[model samples]
Target: MEPRDTATRYDQIARWWQSQHQNSSYGIAQLKRAIQFTAQRYLALDVGCGSSGRFINVLLQHGFEAEGLDISREMIQLAKEQHPGTTFYTEDICCWIPPKSYSLISAWDSTFHLPLNQQEPVTKKLCNALEPGGVLIFTCGGGSINGEISGSFQGQDFDYSTLGVDAFLQILTEQHCTCRHLEYDQYPENHVYIIAQKCDRSTSTTPN
Candidate 1:
């Protein structure tokens, strides 16, 4: 799908997302782990942050300056209402230029929406936004590229071109980031969680 179409898709689903996932056990557990794994109290950007703002709230509670950007205006508005103390913007993740470096950057389930062709550049930008030893946590379905799935909220799709644990590690390594931790397991619903840390230059070397 084209970029604008993708944004519109999420915009259509924003309200349903807030209502359905607000009390999701899986969602809460993931946010909790993300907060606990953050190594420093610095700026963080929640890319594709949906209406719930659960992860952003967790970051704020842990003393991090958190900001969120989502393609859906409806989602951003809801997030603002729920989290007035934090900043929320209605912008596409692929086009949004983060204002400053972050110690932690999370994409959550949002990355799966990007077309396979756009994933690499977006991943590179996400890595560049991180501080020397920053962390990036995200999740995706475990599978190969497939056709779109239309549902009540919107048309959902999967592009494994940028999915899976090994592909995630390769992207980080090529970006001069280190893989400090990785966990691969299919939850009951077959989602995979992949977490990695940007390497500290004092310890990692870049190619000349």
Candidate 2:
């Protein structure tokens, strides 16, 4: 499904999601692990931040000025209510532009929802939007090929896609990022997460 369609679908269950994840530890541990690699805490972003405000809270607690972006109006609305002063956007990441460089960016379980064809460019955009030495943490369906799949959650049918491990690593290299870590966090499930840090091309080297 398109990001817009997924946004509408999430709107149908935004409140449900908020209630379910209010205290969930699902991605909290993983996010913390990713945060440890970043040396700067000036600015961070939570793309596809749902209504729970979980990731945003963590970022703020760590001294970063955090902003959120999600395509769902309902999700963004509830997020605003939970964190009044924090900035949140109601735009698709595929088309939304980053206003400034970030010290860290977390996509978590969000970017997997993008259309397959948009993955490469969007990934590159995110990497380019990072400051030198900035880190990016994101999840994807683990594999060695590119593909799409549909699944149901919260009574809503949603779609997910992946560029697979190799391709994603390739993009990171091309964007002057070094893959810091990669893992199949959920071994039985095809869930994979990657931690990448952008390097100063002038003083850094991309692996051959």
Task: Please list the residue runs of candidate 1 whose C-alpha ends up more than 4 Å from where it truly belongs after superposition.
Answer: 144-164, 188-190, 202-208
lDDT by residue (51-81, candidate 2, tens digit) is 9999999999999999999999999999999
Per-prediction TM-score to the true structure, in the order listed: 0.83, 0.96
Question: For model 2, how many clashes?
Answer: 0
- The backbone clash count of each candidate, in order, is 0, 0
Cα error, residue 128 of model 2, in Å, equals 0.8
lDDT of 2 at 40: 80
Q: Can you write out model 1's per-residue Cα lDDT over 1-208, one digit (the tens) per residue? A: 6657766766777788888767665455655675566567699888888898777877787888999988878888888988898877788777888778998888887876777666777888899898887888776655554323333434554233344556666788898777654444454555666666777776576789
Worst 10 residues of 2 by lDDT: 198-207
